[model samples]
Target: MPGIRKSLLQLVFSGTSMRRWNDKMRPMELMEVDKQAHKMIMAWMLYMLNGSDLDRKDFIDLGDKIVLGGMYDYLYRLVITDIKPPVFYQIKANPAHYQQLTQWVLEQLKPRLQSLGDPFWKGMREYYADGASRDDLASRILDAAHLLASQWEFHLIKDLNPKDEEMDEIEANFIQGIEGFQDLIGVRELMQGNKASLGRFAQLCGQLRFQQRWSQTPRIPETAVLGHMFIVACYGYFFTLMVGGCKARRVNNFFAGLFHDVPELLTRDIISPVKSSVKRIGDLIKEYEFKELDSKIFRTLEQGGYFELSRRLKYFLGVDVGSEFASTICLEGDTREVEWDQLQTIYNNDDCDPKDGFMLKICDDLAAFIEAYTATRNGITNDQLQQALWKIRKKYQQVSLTETMHIGGLLADFD
Candidate 1:
């Protein structure tokens, strides 16, 4: 009986050792697989980051390619190795590989952790989580990752966030305000005309345009137009209060700055030379624009049951009516040729006053020049600054008497 007990104890100890060995070996194998997968995924990410300058047209297809080629391998290796054996065996036995892959990807990406710094590392961790459905996981992961990546490309790469604490705070707060406004009113839905026109007016202040020209110009990134508008609106509100304007006027000034360049949505920034050379071109362009606005674009909105959207835009932007403030805000003709008297008349309009125009103009110029200074700090030439300054100074001459005095004093201080 004693011999039998000793033999049983020895058998149990040997079994435990073998089990530990097998467990350790499995992880070693998994690690090897993961290393290969990691290398492959890293290469793929690098390729995607640099291989193509994808525009709006290429985004979907490129996303598909990344999922199939890179994400699939990384996700599959993780699930097969890291997940509990029972689940892994079940998934491996499933015939629908794509479905399984999708499910696993979703499980990994559901939390959508943003890259506080390294997107690649965060993405890898996301890929390794083995619990969620693939489609949902992949969607969330890609969305968050892409958002951070886009911001990095557009803003950070240009060193827009300067090292200076004050400037960083100013820029950060301004961006936060813009993003907050978007969240407050649901910018995506508004821009698509799924919401009211006033909402769209708000969203318009958030849309970023002219990415290519952004790096070259001394102006704020076209992407930050909405953001800059919000800042201007804030300043306009404060300035109005300082000057003892009515609350209604202050609110109007904010809206004016917010929607000041909505026409650019259609016309883009028609450069000065383009507007100057063609006779009757400005009128023709406006006529074409009015037709387009009334045609497919707005009609599409109406058909889609966004009548409130169209109505609100028409009311706030004064699209159908003659509004001196709106007209002044419009980029109709060559600003180079615009007369001081013409500008004064626009400022003195009944619905909006010169004070609003002056505030808007100052804010606009200040934004432009600050952007120029930022660009110069980022290694852009003084030539770019000079060009921006020249364009701004041209309008300075056309400002109202009050604006002229205020801006003159401001410029003197800067000098």
Candidate 2:
């Protein structure tokens, strides 16, 4: 079950949420970027499968092609929708309001959509025509999202590398999780199903492993997002397991660890100090990111009618535009028991337990230390890496986050 959830969450973050902008403002390749966005949309689909029945009823009613295609189309629309002021957030995309949207997507993804001219895509095109029901178009978009998301390679996107037998076990769980649905899950093709786009997507996800983090830095044995996430996930998993985290708690922590840094795909890895340093300026950046995510990510999920994923992402990332610390802000310092308990009362639906959240933070810090240690071992002798390692050792040597953590040994074992 955990493996299935991990695989699904991995798909969502697999796609970079938006196109990378350069110094001169020329756009980067859409294949990788678009793939990441599409995967995130698919993340919502996976979430639906993992979530409650009521949450899935909307898409289930619309039928399969629409469910798969419409999710893609609907989630994909978020990328195309321009980021305007918060005032525009209230305006939902209705059929009457989106003729231009249809025109734009057709222009961009025309070949891919056209090549795989399924009935769902046809319905989406029909919705743009006069008097056609938006309902059909909406469903088709979800279908498109699922189809596009299907074009993925888990090995590429996920930080995991399972053994053959382990993979077989995971696959069985993945299949058995949704009765009558395993056959539907696969890599889809734009030209047709003859070629293996799913396999290609897996390769793309695999390449993400090599996409270096902090490229500007003089790093040794450079830490990639792939390894970082995997280590953090393991740390969280083991820590949660040791602390007696509940089933839901473990899943939440594992997922949170897996996806906590996904926003770096767009923002590059803006260090926490920079985000929190300049008071109002950091607030402004946070504000901008919230708006952008809504436009570039959440809006698609919302319109495609996947609310659960939206809420979950906001909670884990702490970017909720609606609330102070997004959904998971733990008020600074009382005691772990009080703060964790308080969080439960505050956000009843949050998937990550308060304990899981704390454990994730601890593991996150530990992973940062591991990165520095690994980099230095690889011959990265920069003062930045040196200071990073020193500061982490100094701070964590005497811990206060929770009594359950064996922080000293955790770091030592990694060393």
Q: Name the best candidate (by lDDT).
A: 2
For model 1 the TM-score comes to 0.41
The per-model lDDT (C-alpha) reads 0.40, 0.46
- Across 100-128, the per-residue lDDT of candidate 1 in tens digits comes to 66565545533321211233334444543
**Model 1: pairs clashing at backbone N, Cα or C within 3 Å:** 102-134, 103-133, 103-134, 106-134, 106-137, 107-132, 197-309, 205-226, 208-223
The C-alpha RMSD of each candidate to the native structure, in angstroms, is 24.4, 18.8
lDDT of 2 by residue, 1-415 (tens): 1111222222232333333211112222333333433443344344443334433333333323333343344334444545441212223335544555556666665444442234435654655564224344334344344334432333232234343344454345333433333333331222132243333322333344445666667764455564455445545644554444444444455556656655554455677667778868676766676777667556655564546656666665655333222224333321123244444344323232343455577777776765676667767788777787777777777664346444654454445
lDDT of 2: 0.46
lDDT of residue 197 for candidate 2: 35
Work out candidate 2's RMSD over C-alphas.
18.8
Please tell me which predicted candidate would have the highest TM-score against the true structure: 2
TM-score of each: 0.41, 0.50
**Residue 208 in candidate 2, Cα distance off native in Å:** 6.3
* lDDT score for residue 394 of model 1: 61
